[model samples]
Target chain A: MTDSWLTSLITATPQEGFELAITLSRRGVKYTQPDPEVLHRLRPDYANSADSLTAASHVIAVNFQTVAAANNYWRT
Target chain B: MTDSWLTSLITATPQEGFELAITLSRRGVKYTQPDPEVLHRLRPDYANSADSLTAASHVIAVNFQTVAAANNYWRT
Candidate 1:
């Protein structure tokens, strides 16, 4: 039911995580945090610290048109 | 210098790729094709078929706030 074509799962400190979200929001890109249970099921390796999800690095999702463009924005 | 915090490298057929791009564009998201040389250097495993890059599923990077969000959009 979603219109998003691609998603990016980024892991970063809480500060960086929110910063990226803000940046995307400013550009009018939609993004959100993955559900903890779902994330744990999908990527167990990175989901070791569920409690630390909000304090440590977190994942972010957004829609994009091309790989190159996504990369540029992700790095930001 | 980019605002993106994470990147997703999606692999789908050409039709699917363009379709996703269109979907994102309609949503006002920005995306582009990764530089062939840069993509090869960054991900040698997925760069085996440079010639087929356009024909095969391509990578699409984007910024996100959480892993869950990225996963949802990616599946779309």
Candidate 2:
């Protein structure tokens, strides 16, 4: 398999993120909690919403081999 | 504290992400591995960049208490 990947974000309550992490990991899908620093650097909207974002919920950054695959995983 | 928050994404190599996770966690920052399904659902660009993004590196989603805090963490 290639060593490249794409990234996406999912904002959810800490409770939901915790549950999803378990679900995705069991399915052999890869993901990570975004580094607030890194997120601030990459996404402007994230930077703008920092306080609200951190105070209430968490952000999850997911990886995938293809857009279709990522879409399928999320939608399904 | 209120229970609402925003979200964002950061794409990087797996190596860098691992290291940053260590650094942030040690500093008392909370984070987690993202669920790819969740990401695909949230960010459309991520879906669009799937091929190139997955073929190159990983994505990181970070959280913070404020925009300035997130910026300070990432920039420093």
User: In terms of DockQ, which candidate is strongest?
Assistant: 1
> Per-residue error at B66 for model 2, in Å?
15
Candidate 1 is scored at a TM of 0.21
In terms of TM-score, the best-performing candidate is 1
The complex in candidate 2 yields a DockQ of 0.03
Which lDDT tens digits does candidate 1 get at residues B1-76?
A: 2665325525343223334443443233233544556544644332232222211211122322122233333433
lDDT of 2: 0.31
Q: Write the per-residue lDDT of candidate 1 for residues A10-31, one digit (tens) a residue.
A: 4344445455543432223111
Q: Place model 2 in a CAPRI quality band.
A: incorrect
Q: Give the alpha carbon lDDT tens digit for every residue of B1-76 in model 2.
A: 1333312222144444345443322121133223445333444543356553342222223322221122333452
Model 1 regions more than 4 Å off: A1-9, A29-76, B1-76
TM-scores, all candidates, are: 0.21, 0.18
* Candidate 2: stretches off by over 4 Å: A1-9, A29-76, B1-76
Instruction: State how far residue B27 of model 2 sits from its true place (Å).
Output: 18
- Interface RMSD for every prediction, one decimal? 14.6, 15.0
